[model samples]
Target chain A: AAGVIQSPRHLIKEKRETATLKCYPIPRHDTVYWYQQGPGQDPQFLISFYEKMQSDKGSIPDRFSAQQFSDYHSELNMSSLELGDSALYFCASANQGLYNEQFFGPGTRLTVL
Target chain B: DQQVKQNSPSLSVQEGRISILNCDYTNSMFDYFLWYKKYPAEGPTFLISISSIKDKNEDGRFTVFLNKSAKHLSLHIVPSQPGDSAVYFCAATVYNQGGKLIFGQGTELSVKP
Candidate 1:
């Protein structure tokens, strides 16, 4: 079965730079979620979208923004990046249902220098 | 505040034995819970899940038990094998509410042969 896909499996950036991460959810899946896992820390919820519309928000920083396109794919844009932004960014997708099981992608490892 | 917590950081189990991982949550609004297994450098893979209305859910050698009253859940793996050594995470979310999952810190399980 096709799984979620994320671009730039690994990224390196400098302080105050801008970066954009893209995600292609499983075919026909309508929900997309973003999470960040820092070194030695649990994955933290960032934001989510349902059917190309913003649905819920979590601990996402002000410098970060995300949107789901009409194709059901999503993108996370980060500006003025800080060293603390370094972490593993994951994207997950699921079909909206009563007991939905999310499928995750390989994840993008961001290293801010 | 940490809503979901896995008190045990790591556990070592002998082959052919049983491995049990526990999780606790403070939010009562979460209606769906799931367990995911993850290997290094890979995204989380769906293992099993239980809804608030169900107390137990089983799949093959993996079983998940939920106690709504105590806001706790556990995952059991019977006849464990060395291949089961990895990190397991407990996650929860409100049904039909954007599907943003809140994850626990995770427990590392080592199954020795």
Candidate 2:
């Protein structure tokens, strides 16, 4: 089975720079979710989309923005990045009518200096 | 306030023994639950799950139990193997709430051979 795919498995950036992460959800999956995991902490919800529409928001920073394209792939764009933004970013996908099992992709490790 | 919590930071178990991981949640509105296993530098892999309506669900050597009254859930891995050593996370979602998952701080499980 095809799993969710995320780009830039690892990233290094300086403070105040901009970064964009992309996610390709499993084929035919309609919902995409983004999460951030700090060292030794639980994965924190960032934002989510369903069928290219904004579905929900969590603790995502004001500098961060995301959108799901018509192809069902999602992108997270971060501007004026800060050191505190260093963490593992993950993307997950699920089918709504099939119930709730969201399959996650290999995360992108972002290190901001 | 942390809605989902894994109180134990780590656990060690002998190979071939049963490994149990516990998770608690303060949110009674959560209706779906899941367990995920993660290795270093990788995304979480879905393991097992039990819904709020089901007390138990099993798949091969893995089982998940849910106690709605206590807002608690547990994952049981029988005859654990060294390969099973990894970080395990517990997550929950409200059925009607956009399918965003609330994750617990993961517990590291070491299965010694």
Best by TM-score: 2
| lDDT digits (tens) for residues B1-113 of candidate 1 | 88999999999999999999999999988888989999987889999988889999999999999988999899999989999999999999875676788899999999999
Candidate 1, superposed: residue stretches over 4 Å from native: none
How high is the TM-score of chain A in each model?
A: 0.97, 0.98
User: For residues A15-101, could you state the per-residue lDDT of candidate 2 as single tens digits?
Assistant: 999999999999999999999999878899999999899999999999999999999999999999999999999999999764368
- B1-113 per-residue lDDT for model 2 (tens digits): 88899999899999999999999999888888999999988999999877889999999999998988888889999989999999999999986888899988899999999
DockQ of 1: 0.76
**DockQ numbers for every candidate?**
0.76, 0.78
